[model samples]
Target: MASPRFLLLFTTLSLTVSSAISGSVVEDLANLQPPSDFNTTIMKNCQHNPSLRYCNSSSMDLKEIFKFTIVASHLCNESKNPNCVHSFDHIDLRNRPKMAPLYLSYSFFWKYCPLTVLSIDLSNISLKGSFPKEVICCDQIQALDLSLNGLTGEFPIESFAPLTNLTFLNLSYNYFSESKISDSQFFKRFNDSSFIHSGILPSDRNYTIKAILLLVGFPISVILMAVCFGWLCFQRPDYLPRMFQRKHKFTPSMLRAATNGFSRKNQMVRSEGVEIYKGTLRDSTQVRIEIYRGCISREKRKEFVEECKVLVELCHKNLVQVLGWCRTRNQRAIVTEWTDGETIEMWLSGSAPPWKQRLKILIGVVDGMRYLQENWPEVVYDLRINSVLLADNHEPILSRFQVGDQYSNNKKIHKFGIFLLEIITNRRSQEFERGEAGLIEHVRDNYPENLHKVIDARMKLPENMFDQAKHGIELGLMCTDQSISKHPSLNQISHMINKVYESCLELAPQNHKRSHGDGVVGKDSSNGESRL
Candidate 1:
């Protein structure tokens, strides 16, 4: 409405004001001050390095500085000196534009203060190459943000074990769709948001159906599925297979009563914001209730529900059963059948079991895995001793922990091999001879003849059982082979194990034949002995 001259003046003023505001923001970021409690001693050491141009401690925490703006003066090149890393407790450069090469960042990180960076944010940096193992060198890292990059090759997820303090992680929108992570708990703190654009994370049911239709040429089944899914979404939302379901609606009062007012004394395992409580139902039935704390995001809640739905649908004696799920005012809860028996790891820590017992447990785990691989869309991404719960009868039940297809079946086979070696050597995968990287390599290096040295000293094997142990070791070695093509299928392994068991039974004394369950033909039940 103003005159042309006045309008022109106003437009010019607006542009000038915007430029000034932007410059102010940049200057403020450049002159950011470090916190009072920041380790100045370390800062002095870093300041000694001349190559680092933008090394400054900051009071700004992770949430405050979600993203960083790079100015023309900003310089973060590779440094040879180890003291040239950023002195700040948190460094967030997410969605950076034309940023410095990742290798430069890595070199800087590796050279100076690699372990000092507590939090990192480098998403959308157009990062190329496989995720470097150097990132794992940040032993004190709590929150890592490496989403939306051009990262390629298999992600060495096992390397993350050293970063025990990691709390928040984001690896979405990257080339991690096909990459495998062996630990299920590693993904528990994160959600589908972290795994977006990756098949390893759960997807929307509607989108998944559409994807299937697209692949199968839009068949009639697609239409049928769409109609059914629509109906289920509106009428029976709980029946849908996808995440976000309410299995049982128990009141907060009922839960509190079951868990003795959620007492700390009833706590089983506490990690992150999740608390597991041992409870007893009104009918005196024992149960383990997992309560997700208030800090859990909606995405994490959905993932928990989705995982529970999968567990509920799976019916296997060797797999733990999911009883129900509940949501209250502040927390989400999942109820699972409680087993009083010790974990396989705990059992192994005490005394080495006989070959027959160990083999039986191994077969149970393999059977559960076979069932899931055949019936479910997921695989056991994290299979280990802690996940194997030994029942009162010494039956091994696989815990409910699944990951997407990013990890191949070959990886699971490799883990099975490791499990075999653990049983044979009576040593953990983490514990190995000096200079050895992994138990697999150690076993392969001294096999067939020198295996006796690594074999459990507690084992007083009968003559016939030695052959069974040797066969197991051979199978283990085959599964652990570096090449995926060389590994045997679960079916083949199952058949071989059956053959071994039958041969061992045939060698038992004829008088030992009895109506023993679990394929064990023996007369003795008391004191766990074979009576002839």
Candidate 2:
């Protein structure tokens, strides 16, 4: 053949041209436009019955970007599509080297498609190189399932910042050598479901490191190199107010004493993410101190403080009061007024609270929820029965205001109303095993003639209260309507309850009457005898 240099040049040019052609093919596949008839066919055959035709259509061009159009909420696994059991609408190949070309094609589709969920279970997928820094642009993605992937790199905090709407992020079973993310930052942005596969230790290493640096390195560095800086700061103390200062005023010794030297016996309650203890201040005011032991970042601590301030400012006779808070080197604690009453579960399951008292408890809880929804600024407390705390008077107080960012969307107002309905009806929203038939189905399935059978059996529903209960039930059903637009606001709900309450008052007999022997009462009017 030709000269050695010429031959080498020819081979290199050939390989470059071949690679370009291959890349072009993948790009074309990703950018393929849907056929004009595609929408018509999808709407006719799959729109209403997405579960049936989503991933089962053999005729559809599954390799092309247009294939993602088949995804719909109804197409979720509950539909029982044999071919599409594990079928996903989007596959992310971020930081994947061997799959770089595939990732490029995927990026094309990801940018074009309206995907809500992305499943990239690349757990064992060999990623020989470091993670791609530019792969953080998938902003609309709600679920990022990347567990079990061979991702050998430091935890990517910046990569996750763009995924603000992510509800589920599974990074378990991956090779992460260093822990750089804070627990508070983690919990504030993502829920517990976000880290299902990742092996997370109980103690947050990130927070510990920051605490050490603040307590040791920063102080020494300031003293050694910034003498004038310290003097100027000390002289112009008015520049920083005492309340606004970042000083660690609460000592570990004081906290230990307040918590009875960390006695397990004194622990009032312990949940997965938090712990509560009965504490006494110097004033001897009893306080229920709750320590949030979850992962949260320093940057997000200010937001958490603002949220806590809003909660503390809330004033209502039926609501629990937040007394004060303590922020130390290692932790954050919220102190609230103590309540000694048993939980609703205890009163209903136990033998202490009587039937009439139980009815009053229910009324008190509903009233508390009503007040919060109406009065609280930019916050809605979806109080579950698990969060209901009882006072010494046996009155229920709604507590624990934890909800995802979905609560802030105006579109979800109607959905919140439906949740309230579930509380009143005492039924779970997702009653069906495979799929949720919703609150309406649950109510219709369990309607009772006696009203007491459907209501809390622990309480006696007044005979004259049947109509009012029905009104309440009807309001609940209306709020939980399938269409989100149809549900009433909390203000509307308050008006409805008030109107019903007024009607009940007008219907009540003026004078009390009793039956001859059983002590049961009935109103003896000229018109007819009404049961009390």
Candidate 3:
């Protein structure tokens, strides 16, 4: 004979116990390790939940889900099921801030399952705290989305590097500053529309118009302008010729003092198109003066000067600053800001800085390319590694725009992808060693692995970073596919690079150490001692 109150409490307790017991598919799974098959039971029970939209339990294996977004309600693992594995690719854990702890726990699951793509688009979730570095361990992850979250910290470039498999990444709609990772043409293939709020049209739309303009309007304009200008010049030879003949005169004495009298030893750099000499004015300001000869026609020389003038008006961290230019008999000289660092190629060959410095250099290259592609639409052209030069601050600035075809067509975007792969792998595009006939045959015979070997040997890359690099190489291969139609757009390529970078960052190690060494050149030992 129990009292009424005690009877009611007992019944309620019984009902709660029964409900907890009945709700879980697995009664005892707490001790099992990850990659467990018990995930099938949980999936089966929670399949109807809206949040688990991307996950399917019919296959009885978590690996079935690939490149999907998962949003589920009432996701639970019984304390007994320790071996459960949750494998959802490109998951969006939005509208569920209360599930933060569960999301954090899934990162460990990511390590065990090695997802190839993951997106935690927690937009409007107002999530806090820094991302755990362990997320970088997902070596297979190729894409990551953590955008629209309240994440705070420096741009986690190092963390993202490990996710070499990543091809699309988004950290947009956050409160980040210059510490934000610099852009690369590699990232141009991906979607960047959500990052900046400028109210501009999508890149795809702009690219279409530019392509039409370049392919149709530009050629016509060039021919029409050339004819009109040529006719006008012929009629008014005195006026135009006099303007061109106004020689920028400099005294022989002044030239000698500016360049130490053209001493060969004083020349800082020599290239096919230009020779750069280090100089100092009477005021003691150091300068770099580049001399160009034999490349431009007399008529084209004026155009070149105008182009330089336009370039001088443009100022950016990625572009080298031009101080002034002069045209003398049989020669044209342009003064520019001197960069302290060496070329990226030199650094890759172990001729200059250490590996950590090289990573920073890569970031700089990305920044410069982003600037060029984003700002100077008319000059958008194919770029290569040789165009990337390290500055005095070891920052990378892009030059040598004169080379490569400039076309507004989206097809040119693939070239940027190839360059991105080159940077990560530290391999020359033309220099790749092929099997049988040549490099192409070799690459065709053994892709991915052969490509992986192209990575710089100076530093040990994390697994995820290596995977991201591998994915990038694959993307490059796709871009260079014999069938041009298979190639992706620059926006797509950018998205891919961003994804890889984000995945790498998520899985990067916590105790990883990087070297910081002096910027001076070492003796050119036959064994990796030359200055890059």
Candidate 4:
């Protein structure tokens, strides 16, 4: 007849009372048995029969987080000096620092440092910002759990390579920016849930099986592939797309001739070991030949071809078109249509245009990026100003479409938000050797109150558009979150941009009416309405 809570409480009290009563009866028997017995002995044991209770020579290690909290050292034998591990192979400070009245703040608990064969648990201890560097110090640690904390930063495999004996690891619920355990074989032993919400995915492809299949079926596949290729050329060419046709594959010799022996005058370094050379093909079509300083392995040659096909096939008005590709054993290059337009970065470097012009260009970039999100399989990483080009016609051309939810957060959207700030403020992040700290950090520290300071003096956002710009700045701040899951969707971003832009459209007509002297166009100060 009792409620569930009352019944549960009643059962717990009854069990406790029964156990206490049983323990006292055994204690009574042990008192009549051995007078030299240990205190609180549960079993009826003679002092000589130490097997039934705790003993120094026992092989079993009693593990209780509260009780076993320190590391101890002692002589191995009477003949040997100290510096020997007499402690258990566990260093669990799991939620202990705050509850250290019993054991004086860990003692560091690593006295003789017998941490080699260790099982550590430091979860739920409010570890924020980054994981403690001291973890890698125990090179042979077998078990570690750092879950339910704010530990972040690069938790890559190589960083944990010293922990060769690490059979168990848990790093869930952290904000790590560069943990690449996903799609890796080395981390396959750990549970996938341990990395859930942290964005570390499990290895889907078994390379061992893949290698075996490649070895056994490669020769047969090659012949079958040729037949399929021929069949596609004769019939269903859609199966083997025109982008994959041999005509787009330019030889190294042709590319070298086009680039005038990789002339420095025509060359621009995109990144380390990568050069973009402006060249004219035999057909007189100008091209941007970007070559990497490496050789393509035979295994990756087919992948390279597939990559080239994808690059050339993605045709969008805003996207820079990849015309063809150049490949050889010692050389590899992608040939995209050459553009006379400058990057958004270059425009800002000199003198950025009015707010209207910059906003229009960003809108084009948004549309291009949206299309890429729908079609491109790759995750877009580097969506910077230098990558977003403006053509001769002043229309935005997203030259670097390398390849998000929400209106939720990821790097591409975050960078796009950063791009918005860049355009609005006429200021680039410290990334361009032009600011203190990150642009996002600067904005977060002082925004809305210091909105005037952040706005570009040169931009002169129309008095009517000022409110819209502020709204956009707020949207950009949200989108730049480190957790991409927090970012708003492309549709949401597009709407905000359009909303601001629509205000521009509305003001344009009013401005034209005023310019035409439409009967003394002015605001009625008392009524706060337009007067004409």
Each model's TM-score? 0.47, 0.44, 0.43, 0.49
Best by TM-score: 4
Candidate 3, superposed: residue stretches over 4 Å from native: 1-256, 269-274, 294-298, 351-363, 380-382, 403-414, 430-441, 449-452, 486-492, 511-532
- For residues 1-532, what per-residue lDDT tens digits would candidate 2 score against the true structure? 1122221112222232233333344453455445555445444444433433233445654334243332211122222333222333445444444644344334533333333334433444454344534335546566665565556666666667777777766665555545544634765665444444343424445545555677799889878757755543443322345664333233344456777886897698888878888876545777677887655677666666666667777677678886555554457777678888766655455564433353455467657666765666465564544567878777678665532343643434444444444444454555555322455665656664544545543333455555566666666566556655556765666566666655555554432332234534456577576654
Off by over 4 Å in 1: 1-252, 294-296, 328-330, 379-381, 433-437, 510-532
Relative to the unseen true structure, what is the C-alpha lDDT of residue 294 in candidate 2, on a scale of 0 to 100? 53
**Which should have the higher lDDT, number 1 or number 4?**
1
Model 3 C-alpha lDDT per residue in residues 391-439, reported as the tens digit of each score: 7677777655442236544445555555555565566767744411243
Task: Sort all candidates by TM-score, best to worst.
Answer: 4, 1, 2, 3
Query: Which ranges in model 4 have alpha carbons more than 4 Å from their true place?
Result: 1-245, 379-381, 401-409, 431-437, 483-485, 512-532
lDDT-best of 1 and 2:
1
* lDDT of candidate 4 at residue 308, scale 0 to 100: 77
**Poorest stretch of ten by lDDT in candidate 2:** 1-10
| lDDT of residue 132 for candidate 4 | 70
What count of clashes does model 1 give?
2
lDDT of 2 at 498: 63
Model 4 scores a C-alpha lDDT of 0.61
Question: For model 4, how does the per-residue alpha-carbon lDDT over 1-532 read when each residue is reduced to its tens digit?
Answer: 1122221112222233233333332242233221222222222221333432123223423222111221121111111322122223554556644532222232232321333336767777767675575556556678888887776766666667677788888876777764454537765767654564453443323433454577788988999999987775644342355586456677665677788888888787768768889998766899998887777688787777777777778878888888877666776788889999888889877865876777788788888878877877462424677778889888888775332122223666777888888887767786644352378777776688887788776665444656667877888888776654567888778887877787787886775565566445458699976555
Off by over 4 Å in 2: 1-252, 351-375, 380-382, 402-440, 447-453, 457-462, 499-532
Model 1 Cα lDDT, one tens digit per residue, 151-259 = 7776666788777888887776666545444455667766545665544444434444555566686677788998987776654554456474445444455567788
